[model samples]
Target: MSKVRTCPACADGAAAGDSFCEGCGRTLPSDIRDASVENPDSVPTAPQVSLSGATPGPEHDGRPGLVPEDGPPTAPQVSLSGARTSGPDTLATQPMRRDSVPSASGGPSPSTETARSGGRTATSAPTVPAWPPPATGSVPVKPTNPDLCSWCPGRVRTGFCESCGRLQPRGRDHVEVCAPGAVGVSDRGLRHRRNEDALGVRVLPADAPHAPGAVVAVVCDGVSSSPRSDEASRVTAEAGVTVLAERVRRGEDPRRATGAAMTEAARAVAAIADSPGSAPACTFVSAVVRPDTGAVTVGWVGDSRAYWLSGGPSASASALLTRDDSWSEAMVQMGMLSREEAMRSANAHALVAWMGADSGQIDAHVSTVTPTGPGAVVLCTDGLWNYYPEAVDLAAAVPGAGAAPREAARRYVDLALGAGGKDNITVVVIPVPGGGGPRAGQA
Candidate 1:
């Protein structure tokens, strides 16, 4: 009913009415709403030239002669840095203001924290309060046994591919992070060669005075089209989570902290590529639990999401807290397209917003939730969510909200891989610590 407003390759953070890529001037993909399931948004009117001098073929899906899948494993990888091709202004070259203002909550003043990344020295200040801290004496992550050979499912013993006969350059391409109450896993999955998705988690010391033991989880999916997107996604996730978590540590307002972090993340990602037109980008989503008040905060760009799996001892209840900034998600929310119809459309998965220099001036979409019972907050990239779009379905497939955070994260990754690992998979699970929770087998 309306002009297509999302970009499949850019899939997570494009603004609602943007007509072209902010990083690149390429025309954005359009959303077509009809029983045909094709994307008119992706249909190009101009002909592209072939190397052999043949007439440019008609475009299909997101782009002609490109993989039909708009996001990674298909073509999402290419647009991670800039949309489509060598368009004129692929990135913003001007300097970005520091998103991290000095903590006003009786912590450091603005003069100390302003834009430290561009090479400024800050006078050391007393440690501000951080939401609960990492668990005391938690064992160092196991160097062996936790990760299987990414190719053959064999234990990556000895840090070599000896048992599986597969050459694993990065040793299973998996990363696991843990804190006092949360654990997250990032995997390359079965399909993609490189794991472009990245995860970050930070927990307060169990004895933290402010929001003791609270945890923050951040997940980002690299735009595959850009060069060295893996690096970009990793940087974005780390920078975003670090800024927010540190802000909380300093007792900053959670909502404002989230906004500041998104700005920090965008700047960090934009700086990843110095060469003009090759800046890398990624989608971002985060979950934070404030145990003292039983509240959960979620912030996101693009489609990466956060879900509250709360309920029983029954543990069957769940709800999606983040609204995807994707084409079809917007259409359904706006009542412009039916849910079933939008999900089935070829352009349904295109991003409406994301993180990167190319994403251009984005405000992180944020929301809060108070669970009725004890549970966990699950934050993940599209690689896992695309397989289980509905919260109920995701809750059903994952371990009950009461399960240990590490196990829960591992289970979700297993579920996605089993359901057909189409892309890189990343999941972070943060358990709600104070309320009554479900028993082990409740779900």
Candidate 2:
């Protein structure tokens, strides 16, 4: 004869032998029912059985005791022993909802355990940092044509400035028929009444190479003190350049060609001197470059000079060649007087040898210099060098002249003018072919 119990869920009275409530179909509290029937005297007191501070019922299947059904709803006394609970109060703080719990079927529900156990609290979403502050000031923009000449502005018919009539080198009117690699600059200084003292010409073979490295530069400076200096300078430049080109075409050695050219120039000056009302003398410097072999050969008479400049401590205006038919230079070299003293001597301008019939002996000094590396050759009359007291000063001006050949010439002329150009001024800049390296075929 088992005692009966009431279901907590439905309050349906059930027989002790039943495992479920007949009215509500809820599961029976087996532990509570069993304990009540087995030990009547051991009935839990109200104070101990109440949910406010309840005592546990008998253990079943090694689980912690559950509260008696007759008492107020109490929390189950969870024990160290392994046990699972399904009471409403036991799951009150859990995240899982009652609907989310699986039926009797053995599968997990969609319940995620809260991460509050290890003392670490869960955080919300993350944020990104902002970009750095804007720049302090605006960036400067460079002009597109930085090399444009300020003096000769805008386009003109002859590639010269229409406003000032200044000739622009490499302008549309300037012809570039010289050897492809050959480039130079020429200009007349301010003191000259006429710019005819300076002459430059390029003569190409019938079948000339398209590249610039094979060009020849012929530069002649007329004697300002002489009446026919302009014509003498022109003949020397034209004849010398032509003769050199003819020799190159004939496959003659560059050194020999330079010598021949100098001879021809002397003859041309003499022919002029023989003409009526002709100046007896003119000064000239000529250079022929073979880019393929990196060779430079030069010839000179009078006080004109040739200088080689390179990219080292030794890169200076090394007077590879010069002509000193002038009395001052000869006096200094002959130990008659110191160079400084000779320069100021009364007979400084008097010449013993020059390109004219009156020169008595037409002696020319031809010389060749192999560059230490990439370098430049400068040929000029005393007009330009007189102002440039130092060689480095002249070297520094080359790159500043920009790509405009005439601009470079203008720079030299302007410099000489500023230094009080007392006579005709002329300058020619010839860039050595190839990059920085030892040159071949140079003496």
Candidate 3:
């Protein structure tokens, strides 16, 4: 008979929100039950690779996606992996997991795992293919209309009627979203003058209670240096989530769906640029996970990130998925600078590419991973990740799947604030349903 999940420390059935194992009093991954941020030793999981296809390496299905106008990247390429994991944050010192990751000489072998006995619903390709323009029809969230002041029937502003200065309604500078399978929260943070980050989450419509499509999560970070960057993030996230979710619902291939959706996100942002030269830009990172396969497809531009958090008797593994499109990453790839040197440089965190009007064609990177156990797919802007530099630290600080996802997101934002919130913080938490599958033989 199949057994329930047991704590790794005590072999006791796992309970919700307990910081320690019930039997042995051991620490646990936050969000497993309550708020969590316990740090574990991080395993470095990125290998330096080179993709030679027109666009670079791995395509959506692990083939080359787009043909780069500049030929191949002058720097060493970090191709997407079909295996499950987050890219190493401390890439230089991180050791490669043993999985015979493909090398520069060969194109990666990607997979197309359709939804079991039904229509398909994924949103990534192993290697990105050429991205076409975004298709139309935007989904708008319900609009909010201010309530009239009880005493003065005037517009409300900061809890006071604009006309009478009478207290009206309380408001928040941030946005909150809650869904059945996922939750997200965006905050301006203590340090930032305004919240410039945006997030979106959706659980795809399932054919039945037992079979669901997948969850789509997107988090975008506005470039502080650019004007109206926050607006850029908002439109990009909203449009991306709508199109991507609906596409999957229609049974499109995940690789094709995600690539087209991200491109559409770019176009949506570009429309706001008034002129191509002064376009506002933001970093985008998103993920789509199928409940049945524990399969994940990830896509991104710039440095926002995604993470897999797994623990317990199933004890699959946890990892960071997407790598940053920053100068340091490029330098590290080119062998022109070591990880330390690249990180220490003033431009280490500066993004090399982003979605904006002036920005040229974006060659988005996509990768897939199927964890054979229970976990959460985390998407966040740099605001949160910057504070937790190491994956171990991030794993500790992030709340686990046990906590309500929206609450977990808020708690994560709180963590960034506690760490001297340096920028806008946005977090989107996606719970991967179904835990404890057959052990994945090797990574």
lDDT of 1: 0.55
Candidate 2 Cα misplacement greater than 4 A, ranges: 1-188, 203-212, 274-280, 312-320, 397-407, 433-443
lDDT of 3 by residue, 1-443 (tens): 11223457656543333333323334445554342213211222233233223222221223112122222322222222212222333343321111010011101112111111133333311111122211310101111355554334356555455775533211223566666667776765554434567777767666644326578778888765454666778788877877777777777766567777887898899889867545667888888777765567778878888776653335334556666777677668768788776665544555666777755644677766565445577888877787765544565675465345755776787777676555667777877654523233222
Angstrom error of the Cα, residue 69, model 1: value is 38
lDDT of 3: 0.55
Residue 358 C-alpha lDDT in model 1: 63
Q: What's the lDDT for all of these models? A: 0.55, 0.45, 0.55
Instruction: Give the 10-residue window scoring lowest on summed lDDT in candidate 2.
Output: 97-106
The candidate maximizing TM-score is: 1
**Candidates 2 and 3 compared by TM-score, better number:** 3
In model 3, the runs with Cα more than 4 Å from the true position are 1-172, 208-213, 436-443
Q: Let me know the TM-score candidate 1 reaches against the reference structure.
A: 0.62
Q: How far is candidate 2 from the true structure (C-alpha RMSD, Å)?
A: 54.1
Q: Which digits, one per residue and each the tens of the lDDT, describe model 1 over residues 1-443? A: 22323346644223333333433324445431112322223211111111111222231111111111112110111123333331113212221211110011110011111112112222222121232322421111322344654344356655444574443435325566655567777766654545677777777655666666667778888765455567777788879888988887777766667777877887788887655455666888877677766666677777777776653433324556666656665566456767667655555556656677666554456665455446678988876787776665676676564467777777777777676665677888877753542222221
Q: Please give each candidate's TM-score.
A: 0.62, 0.54, 0.62
